[model samples]
Target: MSAAFFSATYGEARQRFLEAATRAGAAVGHHVHPLTGAAGEEIGTDTALLGPADAGKLFIVSSGTHGPEGFSGSACQLALLNDELARRAADRGIALLLIHAVNPFGFSHLKRTNEDNIDLNRNFNDFATPYPDNPVYEQIHDLLVPAAWPPSADNEERLNAAMARLAGQRNPGVSSGQDKHPDGLFYCGTAPAWSNRTIRSILRAHGTTRRHIAWIDVHTGLGPYGHGEKIFGRHSEETTRRAKAWWGSDLIVSTATESVSPRTVGHITGCAPEECPDAAITPTTLEYGTVPNPVVRRALRGEAWLAGHPDAPATLVREIRQAVRDAFYVDADDWKGMILGQFRSQALQTINGLAAEE
Candidate 1:
């Protein structure tokens, strides 16, 4: 399946994924013209179905919430649909839902955030939480997005220092600590963005009736190179134990271990489970590794540059866009192989896990 879609762009990968899902006899639903992109592209996110609509157990795999990271997830979903797994899903009475490019605007424009620069992951918390203020983010906001095209050396130093301070905090709660960077990385939005709202709505519509649900929101740009960390949706002992017993060796609970992800605020799956309390929702993020964290931060700097300077040179814009893509996904055969293998393994494990529950 990786051979079929080699080094494809986000749009290309998404289209191929949808085609494969349809070929596998999956019903498709499109959120047509739901949002517009920065370049005014009519971006529509689509959800493909592979098994029965009302199966007892539902396996939901979504990609591209962060936009550029969708390439790898999209490819993995397409590969799984093309493989024998889709047939197995149908046979086992497990409903397989493949959501491609949840953030179509970011995917098309090669940006991680949406048109309004809202990080969808951070926009999922309840409004009652008051959008947890980030004073640190506010302080470094200007440094991250400079008035000039490319940031100066001093600006880089200041940004690096702030990131170092934030990253060094060992406490889980500290990661989501308030910062004053309105235009910096990990900027939680002023309010719930369109993507967050749409996902919550989808969960309410599709996820409410399921007896058991296993959601794997695909992501990238963290952890060891090429490794996919299975981050649990919430920090619960029972859920962690269940994930370990069900998914076995592939599972990496971020709440339990400090290896992959630190506990943070505003997760998409976390909100989904909260919204659909009736269902036994087991949300796990399949985060594939790309560059190192520092390198990823640098790539994000480039993204900020592009976002802050709309009138930048064409060459710089192209370079920044490509850099952001490369940061999350390496266009190599081995990396693609890892992506497909990890996703397939986790998907099967999740299906088996749900079956065990039943």
Candidate 2:
């Protein structure tokens, strides 16, 4: 019954999410993005609120900030929505909020970035203050985003070697966030993005005066196959200590820790806690691994290259798009089942933890 909830396209996923939310007796709202879908349909991020309107404890799950990665996130969201997950949360006196397709434009366009070609995860920064300067990303920017798709053997080796250097002993500097290079991977925007504004708005409304809040931003790529890494971040030591207590010792600290992925600059989940002053917030990312770093880098580059050449041959476009999708989302049933299982466990854990706090 749950497996059928996974959809092949953004349109299908959105429809399933809406239907499941409706069935779960949730009030849903759409923040329309200023972009059109592939088939001329409207593009927007949808939010579903299930449970008491003014519930002090809230559990939020957001998907698709990276676009294609939304597939896994959306599926897990549907599975929970169609099942008894929300009811259980409500029983615990918690409101379950599901924000679907934060970057609807990217989800529809087959690009990881939004319509402005900005990475939503990396776009969370103070405009008054300067964006983080990633010297490493700048040094290898051209190599990452080439004019040609599937660079020649010589170019591929060079780019790989440069990337290898970035993946140092600690694997620290290999991030996609860079503000200077807009056309490159991990491009942080100069201004707040539509998704950023919309998400912040939701957080401000739903997060205010909440006694406890647990947020899970779903993602894929990085770590062992089919494993969900509970990567967390916080503003201070007290918050960090409380979060560790809430999420348990197994959770990975996104910063000041060793991990397969690089430390992000402006993660959206990390910023949510700041919006909720009185709430004891625990924010983390459910990052499921799909493939190795090399494979993932190749797919990201291919997608970026494909974006650069919209006038390219049909066959080439088709090839890159499929590669990018497979890199982010595994089509196998066993893989998706693993995701759903973890999602269920985590959702339950969140409810238990929040309920205890209350």
Clash numbers, per candidate? 14, 1
lDDT of 2 by residue, 1-358 (tens): 4467678999999998998898888999888887798678888999899988878889999999888899988998898887776898888789999999989987877777788778888888877888777787877778877878777888888888887776663323647377887677887789989889999998897788688888899999888899999887635787677667777788887664565557677788766766887887788899999988789888888877766677999898878878878888888888888889888888888888888785
Each candidate structure's TM-score, on Cα atoms with residue i matched to residue i, is: 0.90, 0.95
Question: What alpha-carbon RMSD in Å does predicted model 1 have with respect to the real structure?
Answer: 2.5
Q: How do the residues 92-112 of candidate 1 rate in per-residue lDDT, one tens digit apiece?
A: 888887788888888878888
Q: State the C-alpha lDDT per candidate.
A: 0.75, 0.82
Stretches > 4 Å off in candidate 2: 169-172
Best by TM-score: 2
